[model samples]
Target chain A: MLTLQFLPYSEIEPLSSNSRIRKILNLVRENKIVLMEGRLKPNEETDLIQRTMENLSKDFKGIELCTVYPNVKDKFLKGLLVNILIGDRTGLTVVGPANIVKEIKRDPNKILLLTENVRRKRKK
Target chain B: MIIRLRDFISNVFYKLFQQRKSLKLGIYGPPNAGKTTLANRICRDWIGEEMGSVSKIPHETRNVQQKEKIKIKHKRKELTFNLIDTPGIATKIDYEDFLKFRLPQKEAKKRAKEATKGVIEAIKWLDGMDAVLVVVDATLNPYSQVNLTIIGNLAARNIPVLVVANKIDIRKANIKKVESAFPQYEVVGISAEKGHNVEEFYESLFRLVK
Candidate 1:
């Protein structure tokens, strides 16, 4: 079964950087897709990827991470200012296990998250 | 007279400043993207030495390697910099993947551990780069998240980047796909192992750091 876990920005706002990464990675390692409410700091994103690499195994492949932030192109300076002032809490970050989420494609308007299908037989 | 004198002195200081600072060019990319091969090509051409070894097995370069004080002279233009070849960055590193390459289980596990450290080191070294050459394998899909993340992080840091579409010697190589994937940056296609188009590659580096 596939599970999507929604993590609100407020839930993780007070956590340390390492703790935030750990929280997200732990959920991902459990095969739960994390729908995070804010973008991670650039360094945090790299660190998350680094941590993910360390914990990879046959059962837990890795993760597919993507973020969609709108209006950055329209209001570049304003967005930059907001980002600097209140952290990068303007976008949604999707992190899913690679085995479950086949792909995550983000365009200007929407995100296409493709997942793998699993089938099983039921006993009568 | 004082205005002219001030301008002249400022120009001398600027020239002196430019001469004193050495460039650090970092080669970065995903696993098996020919980063080390390109580094070896550049080093062999200029310093007459290879920086490190290359292998079909991924994560062969599990550490940050550097070759210092290499100078290249092409035509009348000269460029010199410290070259750093970083291990390939990846979101996943399973020891079982190495088993496919016939590596023993214990050795595979050891490589995986070192590879994770390498990824961390590579990301850490990003802060120190003056310019970076992001090499991509032309034969594979260029739209991977790993590529986007690496490029995005570099862009956020405001680092000057040049995309090198490597493995052009292979029949399946598609430079245009790589170019379109990163339309904002200049994409130069070359086969590092075959030494094809390296002259042009050298010319691009001079322009990149200028």
Candidate 2:
């Protein structure tokens, strides 16, 4: 089963965010796929890579990352406000175990289509 | 819910720490392409220490070496990064190739094995790289199979890249060939060994990450 827990961009984007990322890393270690609500800011991205590199081992097979943006079919100011109000409306990121996510191509648009198509196939 | 409270708490913490940070810069190229020469020069200029030793052998740097916290200041802007100097990458590795270099059979095989492992490690390190400097020997034709392979891998990962046309101090060095070969990416010509045009190289590198 694919499971997800939402961690806001606000929580993980801070400079002194090691403990918060540690929390997320622990969840990943337990084989839970995490769906973060927004992109990891630049500094946070660096920290994530550093933390993830340190924790790599057989029991923990690292992670595969993918991101998707919901095409709301709008432009300009409306899009800007919607983005501010609903984080990751710009792009939602999904990180899962490397072994699992590798078989799934790392494309945001195709991820939804593939998941829904699989769900339909299983129901039938 | 706890999620709402957590968001409020994190927002408070976020304000405490935020600033520009360093990038992890990697240097990669084929064997005998002056990769280590460039690595040594960059370190000598910025960190005031050499990152690694350089030799004429095919695979002198058989392991990845790193020098942390290299800060470069040009004009009013400053760029800082953790520098990773990787081994020469090759498509094929045979122990026999080292024998031609006049090494004993036993030592040659050992070096070849280590060099192959180093190549794998360098490619794996790509995932962690924020940007890469592809050092090409300008005295030779830049249209080699190995150079193309390295560029293709960087393109696949979407990592920022800058090609360095090194060895320009040599009589045969031609920057135009290297530039024409990789027109898509910015190419800077410099004689890393002599430190000629090194300031221009530094400026181009800073611009690469910016």
Candidate 3:
């Protein structure tokens, strides 16, 4: 039942500007759960989350938003990404791509947004 | 056979005696969301005693609070109510301050991490309840993490929710804006301090429970 939607870092502005994004933002404004994906520089992620909260507070009525960070294998990167997703429900788990993992581990609140890989048994 | 029959009769009597229903109702909101205020109101009105403390500081009711059973009669029906007050939902916690709140270090750390977790738990708890009342601050911006999370989760579960817009006595309180924000909800604006609109709230609750 879990749905995954991916948005690359470069497309964030256009995605956010889209009317669909506004509708989703309104859902967040109304205190609904939303999962966002993008490649964000450590600092940019933090600033963007904070700014989004501030704007939502001012413009929306009776809505609240929370962000979750996914924890990948790289502790440092995970920490950085985790920081960006703070102030909301986040999951922690190891994922693919060490560089992305390092960014995610930097932030504390990010949970592993990705599903775990299962190891298949080798035939004797 | 005579002894066995007597024992069975006594057991039936005991079972009848112990059969009492207490409706479980949860009061949830963010820090300073007026959960305690509402708890106090219910206690004073129904039980004739104020059981919970009210404070301006957020997270005053850090621990889950349960009031003594209260009995009220509406439309000739008798009901026993047990109200539970929960900690305010917040995005982040200052670990040091949380520690100073007298929670054991280990427990505080766990709870600190569960700030969002607590909100989720509160939402899940609402699933089995007879009704849920989501309190919002009328004086502050209607939108915030606690308000939305609680409402959204409850709505998703299809639980009957009653929105209480607290602190209406303040000059800046905007009842209309709060209502507009939750257009699909049955929102009632009231000042918990002065007990304004409280009767209507109780009446609405009676309708729901009935």
Candidate 4:
């Protein structure tokens, strides 16, 4: 069963500055696809991507970030277009494909586990 | 009768093709800020008849009050504006206030939260509007949750806004303090009842829409 989620880009805040990669890693493990929609600062985008790479397991195929431009119409991209205030400025839409969506749903708790583990590491 | 028949047919065709254009304007402010009075005055003046019932009770407009297709002239051009009037955004409603409304304890608590949520939703709905008119009571202190939230959200979204300090006819009306509070935006003072500065209100609106 496919579940649809509307994740606001503003909700993506850096848990800590210890390791940018760990944060994205944690997010991907729990959710099928972390839909990154919103105007992200340069540093924020870098941190998100790094964290995603670190957290993704070998079984995880790959993560794809889809960018949907404003006022453009393509039938193929219609379902994925999510109107969101990106980076607190520009408005844009985003859509992710089935495989990436599936991965996030399969193991929702992985994100919490990864976050907790990373927090412990930071303390040490 | 041929001319009459042609006119009738054209009218039908025009009705079929005419798209309904509604300019959504949200009226928002704090409790006892005379938000309802302003809404009442606008509705009265637009239709030349009263539609929204006026009241002194705070939160009289508990949910969004919507009046559709109100016609206004701007720079010799006529336009339809839809007015949405909303409840005052007070800090979390205390249990006692909720109980005063005579709701069961549980329901009252739920309703209190719902009211706050409604205010937030109203602000969110303003995203696509052509303009927002933030109604502030001239007599009241300017520092308030609703005033700050509505103004800040509109500024953040870059939505065009007009701050109206209503009830200026009251002896207590302190329009200057309200004006100073929002230096970035020009504040217009008006008595929604006596129709004072009403023309100026429309003029400012004309400039905005143009």
Taken in order, the candidates have interface RMSDs of 2.4, 11.1, 14.6, 18.8
Model 1 ranges with Cα > 4 A deviation? A13-16, A54-61, A68-72, A75-91, A98-124, B1-21
Candidate maximizing TM-score: 1
Q: After best superposition, candidate 4 residue A4: deviation in angstroms?
A: 40
lDDT of 1 by residue, B85-189 (tens): 999988877787799999999999999889988998999999999999999999987876678788988998999999999999999999998988888898999
Residue-level lDDT of model 2, residues A1-124, one tens digit each, is 6667777767665534677568667777776778877655443443444456456554453455555556555576788786577543366666666534433343225553123233554697
lDDT of 3 by residue, B9-119 (tens): 999988765443667778888778687888888888877888677755445566676774578776677767678877676533444446666778787556544443444
**Each prediction's whole-model lDDT (CA):** 0.88, 0.73, 0.58, 0.58
Ranking by DockQ: 1, 3, 4, 2
Error of 1 at B24 (Å): 1.3
C-alpha positional error of residue B104 in candidate 3 after TM-score superposition, expressed in Å = 16
The best-first sequence of candidates by lDDT reads 1, 2, 3, 4
Candidate 4: regions farther than 4 A off: A1-124, B1-21, B49-51, B74-77, B98-114
lDDT of model 4, residue B198: 88
Model 3's alpha-carbon lDDT is 0.58
Model 3 interface CAPRI class: incorrect
Task: Give per-residue CA lDDT, model 2, range B30-111, as digits (tens).
Answer: 8888888898898888777887788777888989999877888998899888889998876445566688889899998788
DockQ of each: 0.37, 0.02, 0.05, 0.03
What is the TM-score (0 to 1) of candidate 3? 0.55
